[model samples]
Target: MISQYLGIIHPLFPVPSSSVKTGFTTSISAGDKLPQIQILPLLDEVLGVHRVNNRTTHQLTVPPSADDDHAQAWEAFFPEGCINPGNKVAPMGGFGFFMKGPNDFATELGKATSTHVLFNYEVLFESEWEWRKGGKLPGIFGGAGDAAYTCTGGRQSDGKCFNLRLMWRENGKGELYAYLPLTSSNTEHLLSVPPRSIQHPDYGFSVGRGAFTFVPGRWTTIAERIKLNTIGYEDGEIEVFIDGKSVILATGLILRDSTAIESRVRGLHFQTFFGGHAPEWASPKTQRAWFTNVSGAILTDERGIHRDEL
Candidate 1:
């Protein structure tokens, strides 16, 4: 079966080139500061890091050597690359850190108190990077306490947790992989873009399949905005912009049913791996990807205007 949606390309929104910089607004004055976790200047350590598939080594790392190709490319774009190893990671990665409450640098930068949040970052798969089946990419996740963990890895979300991550398929086909609170009443409206918006019985929604392609060896900017719905209403929304073009726009989502603190956007979930947890998901050989300009902000409204500006 075809897994992705190859919808008609509306003339107004053209597919973007991975190599070109589109000057998209990635940071906001009112948005909370998401510390570059790769190099934590204030905090002593990240929330946690783990490897998957019985791997012994930590899958996430900063290129320890400056001469490394990943390191060189990272330095070209951001100043931190010189001192901090760009967010480099090996295959089958798992890590989670918060942007609110006591555990995050955000506490020092002021906690993120809004229901809507936006995250921005750039990613590069090395020129020789290998695509083994498919894998996960970093995105926003949140829930009431431990509820967020239930939204991923084949876990069922009981309207308490949610996760939104990007996935890359064979040859770099990309899509928004999300675990949402899908109910019988709102399922039809949530899946507005047929074919493109796929429902995975074991997982969650595979949206915008083939909406954009990740060009190996080039940098791509991803901006995602997530808005929580009114308690008990399907007014939530999610928007993904690849290289500055809107690719996935999902509205009328029901992320939560209550107004609890843990029900709001928590923070970044840095997860990447190959799989179905079988042999095929493992990388054929060692591969690397670099990340930088990791940032986030609270939005004032659904229009995506920076809250601080108001």
Candidate 2:
């Protein structure tokens, strides 16, 4: 019934609760968990974000808390379905924040669903293994030429340095692919890591597979530049920027005829299977960096954002 499935729950991600209650069908719940995914640090608020037919919408905020393990709100669509298809996990379409299921929930999440993953992380070196939670295989596999930790040395680029990446799902066979431009910054060079296979030697912090590395601090504004129009099909653009400088940029990047920097960009999104810099392949330095304020929309079909929007 589709090109392929990525998740089990048709998640209405980052939505706030209509009422303060833990209901799978409701956004609110009496459980411990990180604030709803749509946590806007700057707004001092939370939001419930969902999608339908691929269009994204925003809802009220679920109050904030110092907890990340919020509870599961909905009943099982199928207890039998619990054995989530790893490669394509289900997205909880509509549910209030629920109660936490168990202590090792992300472990459980890895088991029940979301196995199809491409690993990338910051460390002294990259590995040639897959990510496993509890000695069990995940639904996802990995990529090639792991981006290891730079030699405490350093790197520099001309004009500007940027971080670039590509986010794509694999075919059932588990090969690599991309559907969008992940990053297109120009200043990433100043930060140490620049475009392409080369990397910076200094130790820094990064998140979401280490592509969005920044100063050891929280980001004031996190935004992406994009336009969803072009001559061919699936035309779009995305420039990941921190503060206001662009990290990843690709013009006419998404049309049918364009080719891109694959391995380097993929390096950004690839997580670590072999624990390197961060514990268990996480960047120990990343958390020390802060992500305080947050305000970015979920644009599904917009061509571009205003200057202020970025």
Candidate 3:
């Protein structure tokens, strides 16, 4: 299990479909299986593929291209604007996903020491990754929704949650953010200044064992890994992969401290360019690229790599 998680959870080819519904009335439940990226079809499948389901009076929504992950996800989450006058399909956008069960959910369960939080997600985007707050669970976008659900939810003492989002922007930059619950307060990012202001400081996404890079317009994959065990301070590491090439590495995020933000794993979130509202999360606007085979694995232990490989 650790081998696959530490390494990568690559999808063989096509992903299975998840049967999901709309509205906040129904619950995902422990036994209820789900489709990836919301919607009804394509549930439980790997993300990035596009699908269309125009079952309304107004057909403003257009089915996403079979390969346009970014467009597909973005549209699924915010399908309201993806349509036209009557009930038509809108243009392609991005892709988003929601996982109900733990594909190894217990690995990070419990305290894992001083309030730990982690995040992981993957999606395909189009030319642009937009950042806005129009569509989300009430107050999450700043303009409305519960900020706690979108921001503090990760560090909440509750059970667990996961969110994944894909954005379609006009510029070359698009944004995406995933949340992993940790024990603590969201003061730093929730109460910091610009350039230095960071929201959800207590949360972070993995970059394939804390290293990776994702670019725009290209069909790439993002690998995220998070490990935390500390006292006054928690470690936040991220890695990115652009076109299968390593690109970014950020460490020492300082998300947990006995003096401040410290909590336990509650849930995870995925967003598109959260802007300044999202603390601790520096959503790179330029990461508006496409990715496929969105899968994951968890690694527990390992030995030193062969020095010659270096």
Candidate 4:
């Protein structure tokens, strides 16, 4: 068992199909076997093939092509310490995906589709990595839904979607934030519910703070259990786990406005870049970080879905 709370699914365990639906209202019992999905293995399989994109120039690639000028980019920035050598994956010893500021960015490890929708992974920051000052902070793992999920021509449609980002603030503080689009009249810039900022007269605002503090070499496990909200109701749920413990739970939220877009997890949205989006956010010097044992699973408990860390 990699983690006590989030246990690793037995490798031999059968994976479920994307179309399989779960009873959203049923309570998951101790022994109930919910449909599961594994994402870490895909990293191993696609090492030299798949590379995803963000809204930036930097993109993730494995072995460089002959015509690739960035062929030496991997060696120059991310070196051996960032990757594991053996077949077995570990938190510290497994296959590592190294990313640096300015020229390095990771969005998705696999294709973007309405399949196997849960996202899970572990992250470790290199000592030299720099934290950004402001703007949308750098993210570890997030997702972008299909066309129906996002706004088109600046108009809100009957579609639905949400994005989750593990981010850091200016003072070097780090936390996890969930971005839920509000059903507003201005579709172009639909309002977003602030993180933990929903007002409670007695409790004050709840800032969705992360469980563990950001340490340069220590590993942090992050998992997001997402279920699209029932249209027009605050039944949508987005739960996050850090290092085997449930840290932030944002429930009774709205994930969609209409039934046109089925609430299904789309892309894993593997991101590791420095800036919010611009060149000004680029690092002054080169930086690096190591990530390993990335995974995704669909468990009834949501909190128990594990991605092995060593």
Candidate 5:
């Protein structure tokens, strides 16, 4: 039952003064409240924040709700966004941040000792959102802290690190994008609409592609459960629920094959951007997306104790 909650109404960090032009304002001084859970004092200081281009590109601001339904939310603005197709040097729009092991909720989640995790979040694509080719969304990541980037960037997994993120295709089509050890036995369990590989051959494949579609101008709730597989076992599981509807249920996933500390759910991988390193993936114009209610918990057994404890 241990959990952590993040809401834009209570900003995670102070909004940079230079971001005023983007409609970002300092939010109220209400701290993130975690009931029945121990709060980590170094939570804010240890986060790995990486902003694309500059801090002004992303900010926490008031949401565009019709009424007073939501107080505020985090926003990422894409201004003629693209990842530079030719040389693949410049990357525009979006922001990324990671919470690694032994920091913030990661410590409470038992670092690599725990094997299962449940995460939930809400996202809202502004009415002006233009879904070009597609983009990355938030999810979980684990492995060696220095080698965390190994799970992405077309790098193949060597039974060590792994990443699980969401992807959105044209017309708001949604799917699960993951980077992990893929084998002949586990590949057969991947489930998608019509079943196709939607990624580069070097990278990972798409799961549950188009199983549920995202709609702009409204909030979409996503809940995910990740269970790590035993060493040398292909029994890992991934279940996704979109707006309370079970859209994906896949088993026999071989996320890792070693009994190392890095082969488990480490922490949140908050990454959102547009592009496939191609010109066609660019956004047509300036647009925005909002996110709120980012939370996660380590599932426990019937006696309210982590499975490892039992």
Candidate 6:
């Protein structure tokens, strides 16, 4: 099947592992090469998190380090087919803790510099996760944006942060999209890249849009490179690649006002759930997703954009 879609392979992507080892699958063999990227400041291997729904019976466990490359490799399960009875309107799939500021995401990629962050995502099984309820799609915020978790200091509203999200569209297609939130006073701007063609008076702007077919039960690498816009000028830029394919290349974006605080690459927001305050968005059944090679770094030059050495 992979060879059938050989044309889609990005010239720079490494040959994907024919088989992956997970909690549900066998372990990675010693012969398999581990992901090797140069991240400056690394976060905790055990990403300690605060649960949103303490009563929810979701499970998050780290696989055996000997069986995997990264000691912190994590797998999250969302039951066979369960819904949050307490909050039916918004079903909460377990989420990892949100990391903020330099203390947590303390990297040389300071608040004012342009940087690139990289990570890998794979679905453990075929999960029809998107229910298409409440007008919002069902997915998870695995990447970090410049938004705040609480309404204090740098964080203001839901649309105030810039992050990457893995979403399942209403059609059941997997999507890798960028979510950039900018707000001031009463006006709010929510933007998306790759699906960037969407335009509305209230939804702000969705610029350079593109799509990729996520091969279920396979590994997909995501790389995000962003250059903060110069206030008052549409000079901002964002580029995204899925398995090395350039899915979105957007520019002329006005990210923030001149007086607004500088938004830096904080860390992973790690939000996963069904939302929109509607029943349609609920998971039809319990589903599970796995993530690994979760790492990032600053782009010092052009070579900084490549993935793990093949």
Top candidate by TM-score: 5
- List the candidate 6 regions with Cα displacement exceeding 4 Å: 1-72, 80-91, 100-107, 114-123, 127-147, 150-160, 176-196, 199-210, 301-310
Query: In candidate 4, what residue range of length 10 has the lowest lDDT sum?
Result: 22-31
Tell me which of candidates 1 and 2 scores higher on TM-score.
1
lDDT of 6 by residue, 73-118 (tens): 3455554333333364344554444533233334344445443333
Error of 6 at 289 (Å): 1.1
* Candidate 6 lDDT score at position 140: 20
Where is model 3 more than 4 Å wrong at Cα? 1-122, 126-170, 174-218, 233-235, 259-267, 272-292, 301-310
| Candidate 2 residue runs with Cα over 4 Å from true position | 1-46, 49-194, 197-213, 218-220, 230-235, 255-280, 283-290, 297-310
* 1 or 2, greater by lDDT: 1
Candidate 5, lDDT over the whole model: 0.62
Q: What would the C-alpha RMSD of candidate 1 be, to one decimal place?
A: 10.1
RMSD of each: 10.1, 18.1, 12.2, 13.0, 9.1, 8.7
Report the lDDT tens digits of candidate 5 across residue range 1-310: 1122222122221111121111111112212322322222222243333422343344667788823334656677766754422224554677666644234455655555577776656789987678988988888887665566568767887767888888899899888887877677666777332334454487577877877899999888776667887777777877666765556667778887764546667666777888677778887777788776555556542221212211
* Minimal lDDT window, size 10, model 2: 134-143
lDDT of 3 by residue, 1-310 (tens): 0121123122211111111111110112211333222222222332222222223111113223443333332232322233211222342222322232242342333324313222233344444544333112100111011322343333432213323222222233322343433433323322221112234344433212212223333444443333332445444433333333333333444333443233333333332222223322233332332222333322232222112221
Q: Is candidate 4 or candidate 6 better by lDDT?
A: 6
Model 1 lDDT per residue over 1-310, tens place: 2111123131111222121111121223111122221222212143322222233222334533333222322211111111111123323243233333224434432233466666666677767777767777778888876776567777777788889888888889888888877686446654664347777788777887888889877877787778788787777877777865667777777888864445767766655555545555656765666664454545444343322211
**Model 1 TM-score?**
0.68
TM-score each candidate: 0.68, 0.27, 0.40, 0.52, 0.75, 0.60
Residue runs of model 4 more than 4 Å from their true location after superposition = 1-51, 54-117, 134-145, 148-159, 184-212, 277-280, 301-310
Clashes per prediction? 2, 82, 93, 4, 0, 14
